[model samples]
Target: MPAEKKAYPLRISATVLEAMQRWADDELRSVNAQIEFVLRQALHNNGRLKPAKVKPLTDDDTR
Candidate 1:
């Protein structure tokens, strides 16, 4: 199954935006994907990522 998706609006300084775009390109990801990946990593590192709310009936949801 595909991952669920959501949209968010953000504001940042031009310098930060430029740096993020360059980093995203270097990582071979779109800016949005890179941002999401970084945020997920940070959340996991800080032990802030919540567990899945719904239990899976099978292995499919585990991925």
Candidate 2:
């Protein structure tokens, strides 16, 4: 099952938000997704989140 997501209201300065919007556009991600991506990366770098393990694909998996 996918993890459940909870929404939280955020307040930010206009300058920062505009910058994030441009960065998000460059990455082809919505602002929310860009924020989440940055937060997740920060958590992983700080050892607060564990890295995800991806299973190796096999011949049958490609079918």
Candidate with the greatest TM-score versus the true structure: 2
lDDT of 2 by residue, 1-63 (tens): 456899999998999999999999999999999999999999999999998877789999999
Which segments of model 1 are wrong by more than 4 Å?
A: 50-63
lDDT of 1 by residue, 1-63 (tens): 566897789998899889889999999999888888888888988999964467458888667
Point to the candidate with the largest lDDT: 2
Per-residue lDDT, model 2, residue 15, is: 97
User: Against the true structure, what is each candidate's TM-score?
Assistant: 0.71, 0.81
Error of 1 at 17 (Å): 0.8
Q: After superposition, how far is residue 57 of candidate 2 from its true place, in Å?
A: 6.1
